[model samples]
Target: MKIFKRTKIKKYSKDGRILFTKEMKKEYTILIPMMLPIHFKFMKNILVKHGYKAELLNTSHSRIIEEGLQNVHNDTCYPALLVIGQLLDAIKSRKYDEDKLALIITQTGGGCRASNYIYLLRKALKKNKLEHIPVISFNLNGMEKNPGFMIRPSLLVQFVYATLYGDILMLLSNQVRPYEINPGETDRIVDKWVIKLSNELNGKSFFSKRNIKRNMEQIAADFAHIPVKKVDKIQVGIVGEIYMKYSPLGKNSLEELLAQEDAEVHIPGLMDFIIYTCDNRITDTKLYGINIIASFLAALLKNYLIRMQNMLIDAVKTQYIFKAPSSFDHIKSLVKGYIGTGVKMGEGWLLTAEMLELINSGIENIICTQPFGCLPNHISGKGMIRKIKERHQNANIVAIDYDSGATKINQENRIKLMLSTARLNLLKAADDSEAFLDNAQTR
Candidate 1:
């Protein structure tokens, strides 16, 4: 009888970075940082379906910030601190076996400091004497690689669809939640679809075009049918650093705070950011004569993503009650004169464009959430606010800075002040409408 023996896998790469091998994939649980809760949940499900043990860390304890401050430098951006802290706190919690754990952090591959977060995380791991644990760089631009964690073409497509689904769900639920007659109907619908879609995504026909379209339409219809007492509420749009805008822990539950203040929240979808990143590649080639192949590939990917976005918009349009998201092209066009596309650091001109889109869409009450020490966002976000208001005098924009030192009461108070102005605007508009109706009736 002939027998084959398994060989031991190497633990570290030549560069000294710990490697997550195929053998480890069987036993290790990959912990992902929470960014967009709904989107990440869908993504985590996709990862699980592909035979990987994945867990989304939802722990938002005070120790997370404490851990981040202890390990990461204080001057670094707030998002980085929060993320690193959350991961380290998870490791320290002893909830999972340290030897059987790995981490995944996204790299934008841009000039932004986010690209270096993985290295920072590794350094922190070493400082904490957990250097043996592997960290995976989840990026599109081939920034890093691991045998156990590869994003296959099929997986990438599923991720795209997942974002599309998550965006629509988030958009519809936000619009409905504030107005729904039943307290939690919107959340119930959201929970139901998250499970249903997750199951479908795991199946063989996960990528079926017909099913995707049908599911989107069905989701829109479900939210549309929720009985809402539609009254004029201050429509608030949030645009800022990606993390602060999406992550609840990062923003101190800004969305919930706005809802409590009797405002409807509108946040641009993740796909827009993805598309913006792709568009930046093309922009680089045009302006700086960068690699033609990279630009061409970016253009192709951007077009494909836009096509998917259009399908999502069409699905949302199937229900008239909910306003469909504007096309990314439309958003890009809005920033032509306001900011140059070359300002592609951090959120870049996309931040400026989102504010413009929201203003034009009549969500004039804007909260531009800025993280501490993120210069790019400050430039594109807070810097452009004055220019934006110069054109649209009705624009009510508040730039709130968030960091460990920034108190929630201060942030909420500023938001409250903005809401106060929004309320005055709302009443004035109501009075004007009533007077116009009275004039019409007399005539």
Candidate 2:
């Protein structure tokens, strides 16, 4: 028998994982930015099931912002710097294997720095001596390529289940906290439910649309079981660019902090965008009379989503855990009134509409998060707070700007102050209501 000589394999670094060069031998790893918590659970499970080592990086609220200032250009939007800075930190962390990891970022392909963020991240990686790292851009518009990161039908179903479940938990927790008898009870429930749902997401054949509805109902029922007193709770509305409104980093963990302060947060659902996109088609027809069939179909899709929203609202209210339907139109009106319809970034009207809906639904306190250098949000976000306040005097609206150089402590303190005012207002109202009731009963 002839002796075979073995050649040594060369090692390479990707996002932050070990990369093997030989076919069917190299282990692949991917990183998805933490925009939504549910994404982390769903993506990690799917990637692992497919024989890939995937992990999500915990987004840094304080350090990432500071690191962004140190590394990124000062002129870039705060979100851009924070997101890139997060990836940079990940590459340096011991938790991430530097040889075979791939960095992931989402691209909207809009007229904003968000679109250019992917490019900026690449340069930053190169500067940090991570030049060999691969950055994956996740987009519906096909922004980048990584054939290995395919979303199979089964995976997509699970992804949606994860998203909807997370949405429900977020919505329900916000609604329950203000009325809960014990402070932090709602948060406790949320933490518990997230774990439960994460496990449920791992199960096969439980991802049907009907199953999703049942899961939501179960969540509502569980929340209802919580021993909360029926005290009038202060309702706060959060509306801004999609990411800023939903992402912890963008808003500096605004929602969680609000909950801690015993305030109810009403965030407009993502379904609003589907409806708004459809409306654009109808508006186009009215303005130009061009019968674009595709536009009309898009509008139909939005209508379907609106119906879904209505159904969700009905289900929640029928269970009697929170107040009835609150229109998200206030966000739109605020946007239009402040910046006009001319501004459009990832569907400009959507942000505005969400704000308006929250306000109209009787949740007056609002926070609009703006990226420090984001032109559209500046025009549409900061510029409109004053007008929104003027129109609704009770509207306690604050515009917090996120940037690389901005201090997290300062940002949080400012929000803390706003929340303090809300609590005071709520107390004053409760005192007045009790006094009024006493007088009425005596009379």
Best-fitting candidate, scored by lDDT: 1
Candidate 1 local distance difference test against the native: 0.92
Candidate 1, residues 74-132, lDDT tens digits: the string is: 99999999999999999999899877789999998899999999999999999999877
Candidate 2 lDDT (Cα, whole model)? 0.66
Candidate 2 weakest lDDT stretch, 10 residues = 1-10
lDDT tens digits by residue: candidate 2, 1-443 = 11121122333345443233333124546666666665456556655655666677776556776667767898877777777877777777667666566777877655566777888887787777775666666664455545555556677555545545566676777677677778778777777766766666556536555655666677788888888777666778877766777778777787768767767788766555545655666666766787588557756655655655555565566577465444334345555545545446654656555556667777777877877677776656666667667877877878777765568788878777787788788888889999999999999
Q: After superposition, how far is residue 222 of candidate 2 from its true place, in Å?
A: 0.4
For each candidate, give its TM-score against the true structure: 0.97, 0.81
Query: Which residues of candidate 1, in runs, are more than 4 Å off?
Result: 1-10
| True-vs-predicted CA distance for residue 245, candidate 2, Å | 2.8
Candidate 2 C-alpha RMSD relative to the actual structure: 5.3
